[model samples]
Target: MLDLALEIAAELIRRPSVTPEDGGCQDYIEALLQPYGFRRIRIDRGGVTNSIFLRQGERAGCLAFAGHTDVVPTGPLIDWPHDPFAAVVENGMLHGRGAQDMKGGIACWLAASIRLLRDGVPIPTMQLLITSDEEGESIDGTIHIVKHLQSHGMLPDAALVGEPSSHRIVGDTVRRGRRGVMQVRIRFDGKQGHSAYPQDADNAIHRAIPALHRIIDLDWGNPAAGFPATTCQITNLNGGTGASNVIPGHCDAFLDIRYNPANSADEIESMLRNACNAEHVQLEFDRVADAFATPDGPFLDSVTRAIRDTMGIEPRLDTGGGTSDGRFLAKAGIPVAEIGLTNATIHQIGECVALEELAALSAIYASLIRNFEVNG
Candidate 1:
């Protein structure tokens, strides 16, 4: 199982699938699972590649694994010890761009399923939801696959997102929820003129200061249990001319808010509008990803038991992280748990994972699949 996982992970990393591009990775996946009786269902949308691989089970209930084939851009290739897409194995580590963020996780799940099937294990029906739009806009990836499942009434009983959720060790942590994302683009308008002629100029920078301060001062209140408090940050601010003597006519400010379930996107938008109350200021709000949490239930208990049996350790149920494709499934009312390899180097220049981590994670996934149950 370890050898199979390492081979697949290396092959996947060899494909340079930078955001929104499958780069033939899913095609490769299809070829691997086709011989194993898994039917491939394509759900491509807006040029993003999405696939659902399904296999009927000998046991009752359906289990799904959600993952992405896309990887974030490798900034400054020279900084990496090995080529970002080479999949180099050095000192027991598989080094590459997607090694830890996702592709490694996907490989482990595949290995586990295949091993179980070959060994004649009677596991539940399985669905592998793969998408290429996660590392980019995330507009037309898992969201479309989820909609298709809903239309066909084929939604799985539960889903495990392969998002590299663990921190220090495999099975040490599983993300039960993630905070919501809200982005706001605010434009403060005013007349542009010379700095010397202060009376003639309606400085946009001057107009933006008070409103920004008000936004920063807005109360977010306490967060929900096992979650962090709502955080609003002014990520970007631009309002200047080339000449120091010029007073800018407009200032654009971008706000990125990660809030727990305690705060709704609508509530945050309302508070923001109240802060930037001037008629000259225009605010555009985008509810990127809604906050979602899977309450403790049979699904979670099963995952915990599988981890305990495989790793001999208690796994922490965490709700931290920016966001993930799991939100789409959670929004569809399916219980979602994110369990995967450790995330020490995800999105870093030298993103990689240990070979042992893959082996352990694969074993845990195999156990989870063998023990999955449906709510009757």
Candidate 2:
């Protein structure tokens, strides 16, 4: 299994599967799964690459594992200690792009599946959903995959997303859920006039200032679990087109909201609408991901027990992060949790993973699978 882990990670790194590009990363995974008895399903919708492979069991519900193969671009390759694609193992760490953020995770799953198959274990059905569009818009990855699952009745009872959730140790933390994300583009409209004649026309920037303060002042983090309330921040702004003398006709700002579970999407949308007022400002929102809370039920209990039994410590339940593919699966009401390697180096040049954690995570996954069968 360790050999498989190392090999797969290197092979995956060789492919430059950046956001929204498969880069043959999914194809490499399918090749490994095919030899092991898992049925690979390539799900492409509207030019998106999301592939799923399943190994059916004689029993009932499915145990699903979700992850992405896409890696963020390796910026200024010279910063890396070794070739990001070479996948050098230096000082007990396998260094490469996507080593920690993902590929490491996918490798662990592959290793676990191999061990499970070799053990002749007979239990619930298992599924693996992999996509390469996570670092981008994420619209074509897990979102479309979940929709495909629903239409064909492939929704799993529970899912484990292989996101780099642990802050320090491998199981030190687990993400129970993620805050919903909304990227808003607002355009404040006003009549262009001379800067000297202040009363001739409205200044869009001046009108936008108050609304910006209102948005900045809203609480985004939740009180419970240290989760902040609906977090709103202005990411970018543009008004005048170079000439200082001109009063711009339009002022634009990009706002990002990471809202908590306490508010619905409609509620947040209404907040934006009301704040914009009728000042001719156009408020447009494009949802990146929805907020999902993990249930404290049998599924979670089983995973928690498995982690404690293996690591001798209970993992912390966290809700901090931009988003994960789990966002889509959680929409089905399945309890979702993230478990993976340390995330300190993800998306960075010379990204790496501790080799020991790779082996440990694989064993941990296998143990969890066994525990799920026994507890179920």
Candidate 3:
């Protein structure tokens, strides 16, 4: 199992599929699964590659594994210990850009599925939802696939997102939920004038300061259970012209808010508008991702059991993380759990994962598939 996973991970890393570009990664995946009785369904859009590989089972329900083939850009060739796309393995670590975030995870899932079939294990209907737009705009990624499944009444009972969710070990942690992201751009308008003529022009900076203070102090209520409190930060602020002698006519501020389910986008937007009460101020809010939590139930219990059975460790059910494609599945009323290799070096220059960790994760995924029951 480990050897097969390593081979697939190496092949995937060799492709420089950055952001929205698949770089032939999906084609490679399709080729691998087609021989295993999996049928490929293409749902590409906006130049983004999305495919669903479905393998019918002798069992009753369908199970889906969601993942991405694309990776973030490599920062600099000189900075990396090995080529980011080289998939080098040394000292038990697989080194590359997507090793942990997460070509490695996808490899583990495929390896487990292949092993199960070869061993004559009774498995449920399986679906591999692969997308290349995860690291970019995400406008035409898994969401579209979920829509297609929904229209055809083919939604799985649950889904396991192959993100690097573990922290210290392969099965030490799993994310049952994620906080939502909201971004705002606020622009304050004022007449420009010479600094010496204070009475002739209103200072945009002066107008922005008190409102920003109000925004900073606005009350966001207590957080939801099993999640962190809502957080709002003024990420960027620009007010003055380069010339100190000029009172700027415009001031711009950007806010990044990560909110728990306790606060809705509507409530947050209303509060910001009321706080920046100046008529000349303009506020634009983009609810980038919606907060979602899968309540504790059979699906979660099965995942925890699989981790404990495979690695002898009771995993932490966490909700802390940046937004992910899991939000889309959760929004569609499907229970989602994120599990995979350790995320110690995800999105870093020296990003890599231990070969043993990949093997352990593959075992865990195999356990999940073997023991999964839709009505459990």
Candidate 4:
């Protein structure tokens, strides 16, 4: 299983599939799963890339493993010891793009799925969901795959996202939920006029300042919403010309928001508009991901038990981090838990994964699959 995991991981990192690009990584994944008996479901709706592969066991429910095949672009190649897509392994550390950030998790998970298939003992249906977009402009990916599933009347009983979650020793931590993410791009308008004739035109900068401060300072996170104290951050603000004397005609600010599940995207937008009482302000929203919380259900317990059995540690369920594909599944109303290698080096230049952890994760996943749908 470890060999298979490494093979898959190395094969993937070699593909160089940066965000919004498949780079044939999806093809490789589908081919690898085909020999293992999983049926692939392709979904290409309006330029989005997503696929779901399913393997059924005769058990009473369904279990899913989800991951993104995309990796964030390697910022600058100079800092890396070798090519980011090289997938070089040395001294027990595998280094490459997506090595720690997550291609490793996907590989380990696929290995487990194959192992479960080899066992040939009937269990619940198992699905593998892999997407080609996650690191940028996530316009499609998980949500699209899920929408396709919903349209086809196929939803899972539970899911496990192979996102990098462990912080220290493998299995020491597992993220059970994630905070929601919301962003707004607002444009404020005012009549253009000369600097000396400021009275002739309303300064959009002046008109927008008070409202921007209010919205930026507004607490978006609410306890009842199951999140930390929500706060809004203005990422970009522009209003003035090169000439300091000119009072710009238009002001624009980009806002990013992360809240909890209790508030809908529409509610957050309304809240922002109401708080930002600027006249002629235009708002555009992006990927308003809702928060997710996986209850202590059968699937959660199975993962915990699997971790303890494999790694000799009791895992913790946490809910506080940036968004992931897990939110997509949670929105689909499936109970989910996360388990994987330490994330200390994720998205870093070296981005490596511990070999032993990979083995342990595969073991844990296999154990969980065997025990899946079992009553507590």
Candidate 5:
């Protein structure tokens, strides 16, 4: 099983499928699963590749493993110890761009499923929800797949997202939820004039400082249980012209907010707009991703039990992360759990994963599949 996972992971890493590009990764996956009685359903849209590989089981329920074939861009080839797309294995590590972030997790899940089938183990109905639009603008990614499944009444009983959620070791942590993201762009208007002529020119920077201070001081309210407090940060600010003597006509500031379920996007927007009450200020808000959580229940218990039984350690149920496609599934009423390899080197120059970690994760996934049962 470990050797099969390593081979599959290496093949996926060598594809160079940057965000919004599958680079034939899905084609390879289809070929591998076709012989195992898995049927492929394509949901390609807006130049993004999405696929659903399904295999009917002799058991009672359907379980899905959601993942992405896309990887973030490798910063620079010269800075990496090995070629980012080479998928080199040395010193017990597999080095490549998607080695830890996602492709490795997908490979492990595939290996586990195949191993179970080969061993003649009866498993639940299985689906592989794979997309290529995760690391980019996720407009037409898993949401589309989820919508299609809903229309056809084919939603899975539960889903496990392959997002590399472990912080230190495989099976040590699993993210049951993620904080939502909201971004705001504020532009303050003022007349451009010489800095020396304060009376003739209204200083945009002067107007921005007090307003921004008010925004910074606004209260976002208490966080929900088992989640972090909402955080708002001024990520970018620009006001002055190239010439020191000129007062800028416009000042732009960008706010990135990560809010929990306690606060809605509507409330956050209202707070920002009310704080920046000046007549000349214009605000643009983008609700990038909505916050989601899966309550402690049978699905989570089964996953944690599998981890504990496989690795002899209890997995921590965490709710910290940027965002993921799991939010889409969670919103659609599917119990979601994110369990994968350690994410220490994800999106880094020398991104890599230990071969041992891959084997352990594969074992956990196989256990989960073998013993999975849907609870009402």
Candidate 6:
């Protein structure tokens, strides 16, 4: 099983799939699963590639594993010890761009599923949801797959997202929820004039300072349990006109807010509206990702039990990540848990993962699949 996972992971890492490109990763996955009776359903849209590999089971209930084939852009090639797309394995580590972030997780899941099938183990129907639009704008990725499942009445009883959620060891931590994301673009307008005469120039920067201060001071209240307080950051601000002597006519600011379930997007927008209430100020809000949580139940119990049984350690049920494709699955009313390889090196220049992690994660996934039961 470990060798199978390593081979698959190495092949996927060598594909050079950056951002919205699949790099033929999905095609390889289809070929691998086709022989195992898993049928692929394509949900391509807006240039994004999405696929659902479904296999009917002899047992009751359905299980789904959601993952992405896309990886973030590799940084400076000279900075990396090995080529980012080479999938180097040395000193017990698998080094590559997606080794920890995602492709590794997907490979482990596939290994576990295939191994179980080869052993003739009776398992629930399985669905592997793969997309190539995760690391980029996720407008037409898993969300589209979920919509298709809903329309076809094939929603799974539960889903496990392969998002590299572990901290120290594989199976040591599983993400039960993630904070929401809201990006704001604020434009402040004023009359541009000479800076020499304050009376002749309306300083838009001056008008923006106080309003931005209010936004920073806005109370987001307390966060929900197992979650952190909401955070708002002014990521970008520009107001100067090239000439040091001239006052800017307009100021542009960008805000990135990460909020827990304690605050809804609507409420946050309202608060921002009140803060920047001037007629000249315009605010555009985009609810990029909505906060979601999977309450403790049979589904979570099964996940924890699988980890404990396989890894011989108590798993920490955490809710402290920026955001993930799991939110889309969770929003569809399915119990969702993110369980995967350790994420210590995700998105780093020399991103890598221990080969042992692949084996352990594959074992945990196999255990989970063997003992999974739908939560009422």
How well is each residue in 249-364 modelled by candidate 2, as lDDT tens digits? 89999988877767777878888877776658898889767787785668777777777888888888789877788878888766788988889998777799989888878877
lDDT score of residue 134 within candidate 4: 76
Over the full model, what C-alpha lDDT does candidate 6 score relative to the true structure?
0.92
List per-prediction Cα lDDT, in the order shown.
0.94, 0.82, 0.92, 0.81, 0.93, 0.92
lDDT of 5 by residue, 1-376 (tens): 9999999999999999999999999999999999989999999999999999999997999999999999999998999999999999999999999999899999999999999999999999999999999998888999999999999999999999989999888999999999999999999999899989978998898889999999889898888766899999999999888899999889999999999988888999888989998799999999888999888799999999999999999999999877888999999999999999998999999999999988999999999999898762
* Per-model TM against the reference: 0.82, 0.82, 0.86, 0.80, 0.85, 0.84
For candidate 2, the lDDT comes to 0.82
* Candidate 2 clashing pairs, residues 3+ apart or interchain: 220-228, 220-229, 220-230, 220-231, 221-228, 221-229, 222-227, 222-228, 222-229
Q: Write the per-residue lDDT of candidate 4 for residues 1-376, one digit (tens) a residue.
A: 8998999989999998887777888788889888876788888655556888887668877888888888887878999988899998899988898987788988888888787777785667888888888777776788888888788888888888888888788788888887777878888899877889888987988878888878867665554323465556899998877786777889989988766666667878888889777568888898566777876667777888898888898887777667788887888888888877778888887788888878878888888888888342
Error of 2 at 32 (Å): 2.5
Candidate 4, superposed: residue stretches over 4 Å from native: 45-49, 75-79, 184-226, 233-256, 272-288, 374-376
Q: Across residues 221-251, which tens digit of lDDT does each residue of candidate 3 receive? A: 8887678899889999998889989999999
Best by TM-score: 3
> How large is the C-alpha RMSD of every model relative to the true structure?
4.0, 3.8, 3.2, 4.0, 3.5, 3.6
Q: What are the clash counts of all predictions, listed in order?
A: 0, 9, 0, 1, 0, 0
What lDDT is reached at residue 104 by model 2?
93
Candidate 6 TM-score to native: 0.84
Model 2 spans with C-alpha error above 4 angstroms? 20-23, 45-48, 183-226, 233-256, 275-282, 373-376
